[model samples]
Target: MKLLFKSTLVLFTTALLSQAFAKTTICYKKDWNSPATIEVEKLEGGECKGELSYRDMLKNGWFLKDIKIEKGKDGLNYIYTLTDKRVVEIDNATILKNEYKKLDYRPFAIKILNVTDETATINVGNLRVGQSGIVQHYYEDNKTLIVSNAYVTSSNETASTLKFFPFTDLKQNAIPTSNRKPVTGDVIIMNYMYDSSLIIAPSQDAFSATREKYKDNNFLHSDLFAAKLKSEGIPTPPKEVIQEYAISQNLGTIFFIIDNTIYVVDSKTFAILDKDIISYNYIENKRMPFYTRVEKIEKNIFTSMLDYKSWFGFLNKIFGDDTRSEDERLLENEIAAGELTVKGEVYNNYYETMLGIKK
Candidate 1:
């Protein structure tokens, strides 16, 4: 026999606000697919005054699902919904875990079976084509360092081939400093292979300079999307959900702006790779906009941060020879020419699929 109990926890703040009330409802099950237990928590304040905050949920694996705020004649009603969802971690990459309240995705780990010019083959059977992951190499120093990002171009039961985007070392002025390379023992880890980046700002006005600087570049903007959700009468999602949504769009970098500073963070590990500080001043008590100073910032900031460069030159220095034929140099051609296909869609060549010429 199974005994289930419903509990309500009421935490009161020191002072009440305008006679309003706030409530938090948690619906979760101890086991997957089991009957959910609803726990209701109420606070006696309009502003949702309580010591229980969002970050507190992480300890017990509870995550915010959604929230609702309603205005009442007395004051307001704050409704917070949460759930207990599992979070998956990969290579210590917290992008998924940090951004999604419930980290329910499975982690994919694969070994580098072989490495060639700008490409590496991994022993992956479940990774989908176009999925990306961080590539870490085990160095002789006993430290595993992230050397590059890899994306699956083709995969099968036997093996999955990945194209490498070697991280550039500006300090060493090398493609991947210290002569480290992806070896047979290195690992490719995927919580999910993120592709693009998400930039969060106070508003478009706050990001105007970076926007004009990278006019051709495309990235997900947080404020814009939130406003769209608001316009559609949809409540804004939790911060973690917002970032998780960005990951769904394949955004690998998640960063934000505070005042005049731009923090470029790695979406996977949430590490601040670089920071951009815009110079400005108050001219006679009126803030003066310095567009010229903004231009002085790196024009190729995004390119330098996100773009993939040819590590073939560096590979040649170590391996010494262009043994790969012209046909193999191009990844798309190689994928289409071979038995590799994404989602069971076979293509004679990449162009035929791109041009919509079905065979």
Candidate 2:
């Protein structure tokens, strides 16, 4: 019975968010004969063996997307209306073991409206985390309906408002390729991979002057950069990394801004990545977090490998002998141990000198 319970839990959760967001799907699918809630369902013997349901229409969906219920248009109980092209068939989905109040759900329509890259007309909704434990679209009042969305922290998402988008998937055609620069006070926001950083310099000399300060203490606010990124706004940003940009071993690229325009610099030549998209913003004028893409920086394996020549030069450079410091002793002990295990010509030459192995 417990096993059956577990299976049912897995069955529902797999049917909901994960299964739905896996692709663009129909929440309520109708076959030739019947109106089936599941997009695809296969019954095995007596029980329902497999099924795909209305949640399939979610395209790159979020866990708290389109599921929140506000006070209805009729102004009575709380309700959330489905838009076009998708439906949410919420039969039973297992959630994390917690005590947060979950929503009561029923099968909605197959109204899958593409939400990403959409700029909503009215500044009504704000994507916020509610007590219900999901990303919910919150409006100012009950009358205002959330018709569409683009992600942003602020409520009023006008042209001036700072918004968020995936840095990697931006529309390439929209960025301007001109060499124009913003005035000294204009703000240019950047999303490097997922991390958000803002550059607030308008001139080349000022920006270069700021960039040179990183060598001192690596502080963004110290003489180098303008200011740190605060979730609230510019200049006084909280001391934290908004998102972590993963460093690649072999791939290197730098995304930097000049005159409110971003340029992708190739690591190899440190030149503009694409001439056409040089100094560009999003086609829709949206700004993404800019990551400085370093070009192919050298990582020569021969220079890094552990060998006699390398060991000799490196040890001599660092003065790894005297055995006074803990670091020096560790290196000497490691080298001595390495020599004892080998019977080769390389080991023979260094064993006497490094380990005091007398002839």
Candidate 3:
């Protein structure tokens, strides 16, 4: 009876804690059982606006002091500036269009629908650019897709790529040189010079079209995964114990782990994907022995740390023999240093994440 009572009390306490931390669940999914109660009010100018105020946000456990509400530059979507590391940029949100132009669409993360060698279809997202010139991949509800005729190719090992015409450009202007066909054997060389232009090398050896099954669909589903972990008594893993992490795009989850516990987050929603208690490497660090006393510093320590024995060493010695500027040499030196540092990194595949996302 005592054991039963203890368990019941623990469960009750956990329930209360969890309820206090419930967020405003804006249902972007195709189906939702209980969505957030969104209040809409009519303005004097006959416009309707959403009512996600500071008080409503605090109920979701968000520290309202860090949130700054601002209007989107496109005048369509509202910006909820958050300081936490959460990827709130990509949330599906309601749009209030104060500035609307005929066919005026804001920059957005393109929702790829189909990209075959013969045709391509995509739904452009409503993008918000921050003051720091960073593009937020979030989208408003009033997004529409555009289809263009194109060709797709596949490559081996290096990477795959998709090429399509800018629908807005094609709609506004006429271009005769836009439909240039790629060469058969060349690898696609990508160059990002501007916001609207995506440079692709015309070749089959370097790039390939995205697979058919992965196209026209949302693959990363973090929120659905988070709901699975909503039960009480879930364990929180240590942050430093995450020695390795990677975006398992094929699996639609961001994998977090090293030797013991593995956390898989939904790539789209940034929600914890694992449905069980996660354990950290509590024993790995202590498995080694410590010295009884301090040891003498060996000359090999400097040799190992500063030895550019590989190509980096050679490059560091003779970086600017050519006509390269000081800035260029410095950039190359930094790259070399980074490459050296990565050799000692505990995690190898950290860059494989979606913009190296941290949870």
Best by lDDT: 1
What are the lDDT figures for the candidates, one per model?
A: 0.41, 0.25, 0.25
Clash count per candidate: 4, 37, 8
lDDT string for model 2 (12-66, tens) is 3454444433332112111223223222333221112234222322222311122
lDDT per residue (tens digit) for residues 132-159 in model 1: 6777877689888876666666667777
What TM-score against the true fold does each predicted structure earn?
A: 0.30, 0.19, 0.18
Judged by TM-score, which candidate is best? 1
The residue pairs found clashing in candidate 1 are 86-103, 87-103, 99-240, 132-193
Question: Candidate 3, which segments miss by more than 4 Å at Cα?
Answer: 1-251, 257-262, 268-272, 275-345, 348-359
Residue range 1-359, candidate 3, lDDT tens digits: 33543453354345334433332222111111221321111111000123344334433444311111122222211112211223232221211112222221122232333434322333322221110011112226744222331212222233233443222212211111222222232222121111121101111111112112113323223222222222211111112111111121222233333233333333323333231223332332210001011121112222334333432343344443575455445533433332212120112123212223323
Q: For model 3, name the residue pairs that clash.
A: 117-151, 117-152, 153-208, 154-208, 186-203, 187-206, 189-201, 222-266
Arrange candidates by lDDT, descending.
Answer: 1, 2, 3
Error of 3 at 290 (Å): 30
Query: Between the candidate structures 1 and 3, which one is better when assessed by TM-score?
Result: 1
> Candidates ranked by TM-score, best first?
1, 2, 3
